[model samples]
Target: MHIRRICESEGDAAGTLWDHMCRETGDGRPLTERARRDVSRMLAASAWHRDAFCLVAVHPGGRLAGFVNGRISTGDGLLPGLLGEIEALYVVPGDRGQGAGRALARAATDWLVAQGARTVRYLSCAGAHDDHRFWRSLGFEADMVCLSLYREP
Candidate 1:
């Protein structure tokens, strides 16, 4: 398996994989809405590809097994400098537990470090997810916890 930057030709497969990730942690939202939102975000990233990064893992037979996205930012008012963030990561069920995820993450984080990021951040999806442990295994420690309450009136 090889990990590398995303290419234009893989757009459709990558989009599908991204929508799948959204659905997994999206708390039952409709797929159409998810696709809409993912596409918009992807277009924005594609618009300024120099400032953001996306990586994909390919299986031996040339299928896209998983993908990750990240960006280095010239921080917001509070942070005040360049910061690296692991924006999104997902691996197909068939490819999990075999180090593909780790390799993708390492490539992104290493790139961030090379870009002079002193601080890198990542937020796992919803409650008590198993991937939290996966992030920890990569030497990442939780810096904060966020809680939310959703209601309908």
Candidate 2:
């Protein structure tokens, strides 16, 4: 597999994987229009168009296997520093455990570092089963947890 920077023309593919990953990880709930719009903005804006970076992994036959998107940003006031925030990382089922995720994350991390970020961080669902082992292997640790309380419908 080969990893490459994502271009604006790849929005559909990236957005498709992103929406799927979000739904898969969001307790099976579909995203609202507002959320979809936000994601659309993110997908359309890359390092060339915005302060963000996105990388995609390509399979041998040129299929897109995974993608990682992140942005350079100052941390929340509480954290008190500049850092890169990884917004999404998704690997198609068939590509799991094959290093595509790692390659994409590494590329994103490298891009963030190039943009002057000394640290990179992302949020994950507290109770979700995921390839966090992959993150841990890349030197990421659970520095903190975000809490959310949603209305019961």
Q: Across residues 1-153, which tens digit of lDDT does each residue of candidate 1 receive?
A: 998777766766777787777677647543596675666467346434876888888987889888888888877736756798998888998899898899999988987888777778898756656778888888888888788899998
Candidate 1 residue pairs in clash (backbone atoms < 3 Å): none
Give all candidates' CA lDDT scores.
0.78, 0.78
RMSD of 1: 2.9
Which parts of model 1 have CA positions greater than 4 angstroms off?
Answer: 33-48, 149-153
Candidate 1 positional error at 51, Å? 1.2
Measured with C-alpha atoms, the lDDT of residue 26 in candidate 1 is: 42
**Tens-digit lDDT string for candidate 2 (55-135):** 889877877898998888876655545688898899998888787888888898888888878778977776654666668
Error of model 2, residue 130, in angstroms: 3.4
Using all chains and alpha carbons, the TM-scores for the candidates as numbered come to: 0.82, 0.82
For model 2, the superposed segments whose C-alpha errors exceed 4 Å read 30-38, 77-81, 151-153
